[model samples]
Each structure stands twice: as C-alpha cells, then as structure tokens.
Target: MSGIRAVADGLVDELKRSLPQQRKTQRGNLALLVATMLEVRSANLMDLAASLPREADRTDMRYQWIARTLSNTLIDPDAVMAPFAAEVLERAAADPDGIVLILDQSKLSDRHQVLMLAVRHGERALPLAWRVEATAGAIGFATQKELLGVVAPWVPAGAAVCLMGDRFYGTADLIALCQRRGWDYRLRLKGTLTVRDSSGRTTTAARAKSKDFYLEDVELTARRAKTNIGIIHDPGHAQPWIIAMSDNPGYGTTLAYSERWGIEPMFSDFKSRGFGIDNTQLRYPDRLARLILVMALALYSAVSTGHWDEVHHPTPAEKNI
Candidate 1:
C-alpha cells in the first residue's frame, strides 16, 4: 500500500497545483482527503479515515477534520472539478471521433437524486459535472439545462461533440440549446410525442410506421414548436425513437443512442460496483453534493491509472476477469 499511497499523494499534489490562488489554503486537507479516497476506494469519510496510511495521523480528530472538509461550504465544487473536467475534454478532443457527452440522473437514496454530465470513454462515462437534487422525482427542465451549461464550455473549439440522453432529457429547451450551440445531439423522445412528418402530416411516435424518416421544418404537436428531426425505428424492437436535431440523421442515430448505456456502468461504479455511496448515511443535500466532488476526483484517478496500465502492460491487461 506504500506504493499506492505515494502515487495518490503525487496525484493530490498535481490537483492542488491546478487550483486557483484563492483556494490555496485548502491544499493540505484536500490532498489528504483525496489520497485517502484513493486508498480506501470509498466515498464514506469514516472508511477513508480508517484506511489512511498507518504512519500518518489516524486519530478521531483527524476523522472529524475529514468530515469538516467534505461538509464545508468554503470548498468550491467547481474549483475541485474544473481541472479534471478540462483534462478529460482535452484528451477527448485529441481523438478524431471527438467526444460524447451523456446527461442522466440516478437516485442515491429515497430523497436524494444525483444529476450527472459525463464524457464517454470506452466502457466508462467519466463524470465532468454533477448536481444533487433533493426532489423525489425527475429533475425539472431548468435544472437539466443548467447541468448542460456547466459542461458545454469545457469542449474545445472545432471538436465534434455528441450529446445523448434518454426520454427524460428530451425537452424542447434542451434540443434548442443543442441547436444554438451547433452541437450534434441524439435524444430519445417519449412514445406519446406527436411529430409532423416530411409530408406535413402529424402522427404519434407510438403509431408511426417502423421506418427511417427525415423531416425539415416539422412541428411537434405535443410541444407546439417547429424543428428539423429524424425518426428511426428498429424493426426488431417495439419502441421507435424520435431523434431531434438540426441536420440529417441516419443509422448512426441508433448507434449513438446505444452509447448512452455507458453511463449505467459509471453509476454502478459509484455505488455497488466500487465505492459504497448507496450505503452512506449522508442525507443533507449540500453535504452529499460536496462529497460527490471527492468521488469524481477519485474516479478520475482510477480511470487515469487504468489507461496507463492498458497502454504499458498489454499482456496482463488482456487477462480480464
């Protein structure tokens, strides 16, 4: 574990070096906090403290300090998050396929909901930004747009960006936002949406024929607005998809939608798969939200290490569990 601790410490130092001048005071505590998360592989403060290096301080006072750092309002989530998000986007931009951004939400508990915007990298969707909504049901349209706002600017100029989400994220405002920003989007519309066809005729998605169709300047009767969109239905599946965009879409729309499932593995890693976030007793929305930043940094560290191993040690990597 000494090697792991040493590496985590180096990573923590790198994180502090990227922080804004005003946040310098948090360097020591933040480094210790993040290093512990890497070692414990859990978001629970108690678990992290118990797993700290044996030579380091491990008193109850230390545990209390860890709790304070997580719950403190002075610790800016954006400052903790922006550098990591930028790093992920910069890597994605280097790829000719550009980057894929996924928008989704999951429940942490009965009352706590986590809204996340992540960048898809192979099997995992690395979180770029997130918000914790206290409401019990789906988040509102305004909140969904706000989450996108946080992630959109991170994308580099001329980098092809693809934004994807499920039916819950298919609101008119979101589609319009994507259009205004000139980014390609593939969203799943609800089966009940009434959309106009290329021939200026309207039909519900549930009743629409199972074929690929493109329409320009079409009206969505349910939303009462006109937009260009593509509709595709897999003959083998029962549900058809209404893809809203400003340009022509083809079979690629279905392919892009399939990638949206990548986020499912990410959520699992945060809970049952890796960190025990689902088992945490933290209930206050603000505290839980702060804790998510810690989790994000830890996740980034794990992914970065995995990528390095995959590149340098191909033989061992091939023997997958």
Candidate 2:
C-alpha cells in the first residue's frame, strides 16, 4: 500500500466506518487514485497518475489494481456518504440557533455530466448530498429526500428547523411534506403557480389576470427589504397578489425566503477555486461522489481550523460545524 494507497486505504476505511451498513470496498487503490486526481484539480488520467507515489506508480499495480478491485462490484456512493451528512448536519441541527438547511443544487458540466451536489453555506462547504442529477435533470428530488432523511436524526427532538430552498421547489407536495414533518420551511415560490388554500377552495383570480398574482413582491437591498404590490404582467396568466405560509403572517414573510441566497457565495467558492465540482470530468456518479467527499473533507478541515474565513479575510464570520 504505497503511493496514496495508504492514505486512500485509510480514507476508504474512514468512510466505511461512518456508514450504517458494512461496505465492501476495503482495499481500494484506483478508486483512491481517481478521488485524488479529482481533488488535485487536474484533468486526464496521465496527469492523475503523476500524483501517485513513485513506489506505487505502476499503471497496472497501483491504479489498475485498485480499479480491478472495484470493477463490477456494486456500491452506491450515497450509501457511503450518507453517514457523513448525518454526522455533519446533525451537529448543525444541534446548534442553539439550529441549522439553516439550505437546499440547492450545483451543476457539474452540462456536457454529459453525472452528479449534482447540494452543499451547505459559508466559506466552508459542508456537503449535504450528491445525486445523479444528469439523469434527473435540474433539481433532484430523490437525492434531496434521502439526504434530508439522513440529517433528520441529527436535528434534536423539537429543535427549530428552517429549510431554505429555491423556486424549483415551489410545490404543494414539498411544502406539505415539510409541514407534516414539523420543520419550518422557507422556500421560494414561482409567482406563476396558483395557490390552493386549506379550505378545499381554489381561486384563479390571481392566475386569470396577473402573471404574478399569488406570489409576494419583495425588493431587498443589502440587509433590508421593501415590501410592495407586484404587477407581473410580463409572462403568462397570473393576477397580482402577495402570499406567505408563516407560523404567523406579517411583513417580510415572503422576503425571508431570500435568506437562502447567503449560501450562493459559498457555492461560488467551491466551484471557482475551492473544489472542482462544476468542472468535473468523471464519468461515473460514484466517482463523482467520492471526489466531492474528499473536497468536502478538505472543507471540513478548513471549517474546523478556522481557515476558510481567515484565509479569505472576511470581516466577521461564524465557524461552520
């Protein structure tokens, strides 16, 4: 076990330990090489091999050997990374403020891509989950559901939970699901959709007229927002109206949905310089997850060491769990 083989071996074992069920890939090498290359920000196999230790540099012995070991063997990366999500998110949920679960997806290359990652906000990228978004397209529901299940336990019993998401998630099903589970949700709804009230009554007064009827209009600047009546006459059928589903209603109810954007800068950091998530060349989803896991581990190290905020020189920053 030379090259990154030992380090790879340890990582594989660590990942397995975090899993609920036993994993089969114990002596991984090529998989390890792939993970390393992806993390090194390099493209192509030859360049990846360059990072291999000289002692284990044999194309067949180290890299190929590791690959042959995993060939045809089946193991979902989600199953492996699930525990890590539970470990990290559960901690966030335990915080006094509780964790702000930001739901968003990051696209890799659109040209024949595989995985879509949902990462936590802040200078540190606490990965929530990775899914095979190429097959599902845009936002992945199955992956998000599985990830939420994993993190649910980490949230203390009766802790205040706030889930933030984008307009892609503006659906009655998701909203009802979160409410049924007793989690406080902040989701951005597309103004075009018609809203149905709980009284078993529906009205299209907003839809038959204004395009942005049922949706609320809020303009935010820096730290504050100004509320106003929105006239969405640009698109299809809709009526101008404002809407919100709060524990109790008031001003800024709909405006609070914008809080999820705070996580947007974090996504930029991962794709731009921190990790090569958006620029991945890996063909397999499992490999993609592995690469992301390593980068997330690096991010976790930064968050633990207070490196992300200090390195980037933020005015005031909070430590990410």
Q: Give Cα-based local distance difference scores for all models.
A: 0.75, 0.52
Give the top-scoring candidate (TM-score).
1
lDDT of 1 by residue, 39-130 (tens): 77888767877776545475666667767877888877775787778888989988776798999989998889998889998867888888
Model 2 lDDT, residue 184, Cα: 67
Off by over 4 Å in 1: 1-5, 20-25, 53-60, 197-201, 206-213, 310-321
**TM-score for candidate 2, residues paired by index:** 0.64
Error of 1 at 102 (Å): 0.5
Candidate 1 residue 281 C-alpha distance from true site, Å = 1.0
lDDT of 2 by residue, 64-148 (tens): 5434433433544555456666666666655665666777766666633332334344433355655544444555566567667
TM-scores vs. true structure, each candidate = 0.87, 0.64
Q: Candidate 2: lDDT of 244?
A: 32
Candidate 1, TM-score vs. the true structure? 0.87
